[model samples]
Target: MPTLQIREAIREAMREEMVRDDKVFLMGEEVGHYQGAYKCSQGLLEQFGEKRVVDTPITETGFAGVGIGAAMCGLRPIIEFMTFNFSAVAFDQILNNAAKIHHMTGGQFSVPIVFRGPNAAAHMLGSTHSQAFDSFYAHIPGLKVVSVATPYDAKGLLKSAIRDPNPVIFFESELMYSVRGEVPEEEYLIPIGEADIKRPGDDVTLLCWGQSVPTALAAAELAQEHSDLSAEVIDLRTLRPLDTEAIIASVKKTNRVVIAEHGWPYGGVGAELVDRIQRLAFDWLDAPVARVCYDDIPFAYAENLEHLSIPQPEDVHAALRQVAYRD
Candidate 1:
């Protein structure tokens, strides 16, 4: 095993995939010459050359459409958006073409593409750059949405996503790009849609993904320290093919759950998970599912206001205490 940051792990995945398959190439703003906006593609351009590691104009829609067309023509394209918030400009290509091509062609044509880049808020990037579109992308039928929290998961899931037959949305958190964790040196792939129990407990469940996973784990630690509550923490490695079974199982054992996300409260990923939990394991729940999420408002540019917008560990701690009847 080797320790690597999320960015390094992602770079390794792309590097390996591109070397393994000649058809696999990268195209996005600043990906080639700039070596990726976040340096995830460092040295890739020099190794793979200008042909494979391509840099496109700032137009997300234009490059995104080109990527889709390339994928349809049998090339595996990894389209980076710089940030997922910018991906909205490519919504037509992602939702209309990449998502529908396979089914529309009755499985004869497939969009073997991976759309990836930094996602969610990092520090005070402001409203335009801070939105989390995981829920939005996950809602689409043909897309596979993956949200990784660790270096290990980042590498494995990304490899799988690149090899997937359909379009996959790989959402990375800018805040987690520099976070270090142990990743296997040998090649590996973590199947999408599998959930990992980061911490096992009996009192309550904390369900989260991406940056929120760390927040939930911190909250779990605080819960144990302050209230002696054992909180089970589940990292949803994949969002779309949500591991509903894992969620139901955790809720059944803990008898309570608190869902946390860095997105808006209304119609967030937490809300959808709560609905499924209530429908599948209502009888096992001792309290209503609690959600720790962003306040329903446009993200503020001010530091203080930004801090208050997203849920914090303290908020998760409070939610955990309540769900555990320890508040």
Candidate 2:
């Protein structure tokens, strides 16, 4: 086993996939010469050459449309957005074209493309760049969405997304790129639509994904210090086609759940999880399901205000206590 940063793991996944499949290629602004805005694609240009690792202009819409067209022609293209905030410029290409082509053609075309990059609030990046759009993509019927929190999941899930015969939106956190975790040397692929329980518990369930997964795990550690309350933490690796069975099963055992997300409280992935639990596992719950999310206000540039904007460990711990002790 080797400890690798989340960014390195993602780069390795892309490099290996490109080598394995001739149809696989990468294109985005600064992806080739600049080695990616975050350097996640460092050294890829030299290894894969310009044809495979391309640098497009700063036009997300144009490049995204190009990637969709390439996928239709039997190429697997990985498109990177400097940040997901910029992806809004290409929303029509992503939401309408890439997401609908296969269905519109009655499975005659498969868009095996991956649109990925840093997502969510990082430091004081402010209102425009700090938002999380995982729920928005998950709401779409044809697209598959994945947000990974650790190096292991980053490698495994990205590999899986690249191979799937559909468009996948892979989200990585800018702040998490440097975080290190153990990753096995052997090749592996974590299946889509599967939930992983990072920590097993009997008292409460903390459902989270991406950066919030680790935040919930930390809250579970702190909760152990206060009482014998064990918290089950579920890492929702995929948003669309959510592994509802895993979540429902966890809630059935714990009898209470607290869903956490790094996005706004309304119309977030956490809201959907809570809604599903009530619909599917209502009888199993002992108390009302609780949710932990970023404050509804736009993210502020000030560091202190930014800290309050996103979900923190203390917020998760408080939510856990509230759910655990609820009548």
Candidate 3:
């Protein structure tokens, strides 16, 4: 095993896939000449050349539509939006054409494309640039949403997403690009829609994904230190085809749960999880499911205010304590 930053893992996944498949190509703003906005595609331009690694104008819709069209014509295109908030500019193409093409054509066509980029709030980046669309994109019928937390999961899941013959919405966190973790050198693929129990415990289950996975883990450790409350942490690696079995099993074992994410509370992803857990494991639960999510407001630009806006480790700890009846 080798340690790799999230960005490096992502680049390796794309690089390996491009080498494995001739039809695979990357197209986005600043990807070719600038080596990617966050360096996720660094060294790709020189290795693959300008044709495979393209730089488009700032227009998200144009490039997204281009990717969708290319996919329909039998190419695997990885389209990157600077941030998913900017992806709103290309929502119609993503939701309408790419998502519907396979079903609308009676399986005559498949959109083997990956729309990937950093998502959610980054330090001091205003409301427009720092929104998470996990819930929104997961609502689509044909798109598969993959939100990654660790370098290992990033490489494995991205590799899986690229091979699948469907439109995959790969959401990464801007705040996690530098986070390092162990990744194996040999080829691997983590199946889509699987939940990983990062830590097993008996008192409570801390359900989370993406950037919040680390937050939940920290909260679990803090809960153990402060009150001897053992918290099991489940990372829902993929959102749309959520691993309901893993969630129910964890909830049944722990008897309490706290959901956390960097998204708004109203109709958030946590809300859906709460609904499923209550319905499937209602009798097993000892307490109502607690959630740690953003206060339903636009993201703030100030550093302190921004920090206060999204879910934090403290929030998770508090929620875990309440749910575990250790408050």
Estimate, for each residue in 23-108, the C-alpha lDDT of model 1 and write its tens digit: 99999999988888999999999999999999998999999999999999999999999999999999998999999999999998
- Per-residue lDDT of candidate 2, residues 169-237 (tens digit): 999999999999999999999998998999998999999999898899998998887655789989998
- Compared to the true structure, candidate 2 yields what TM-score? 0.98
Clashes by residue pair, model 1: none
- At residue 193, candidate 2 shows an lDDT of 90
The local distance difference test score of each candidate is: 0.93, 0.92, 0.93
**Local error of candidate 1 at 174, Å?**
0.8
C-alpha positional error of residue 205 in candidate 1 after TM-score superposition, expressed in Å:
0.8
**In candidate 2, residue 139 scores what lDDT?**
90
**For candidate 3, which ten residues in a row score worst on lDDT?**
318-327
Determine which window of 10 residues in candidate 1 has minimal summed lDDT.
Answer: 318-327
lDDT of 3 by residue, 220-271 (tens): 8989998798999999999989999999998889999999988989999999
TM-score of each: 0.99, 0.98, 0.99
How well does candidate 3 match the true structure in TM-score terms?
A: 0.99
The runs of at least 3 residues in candidate 2 whose Cα sits more than 4 Å from the true structure, single-residue gaps closed, are none
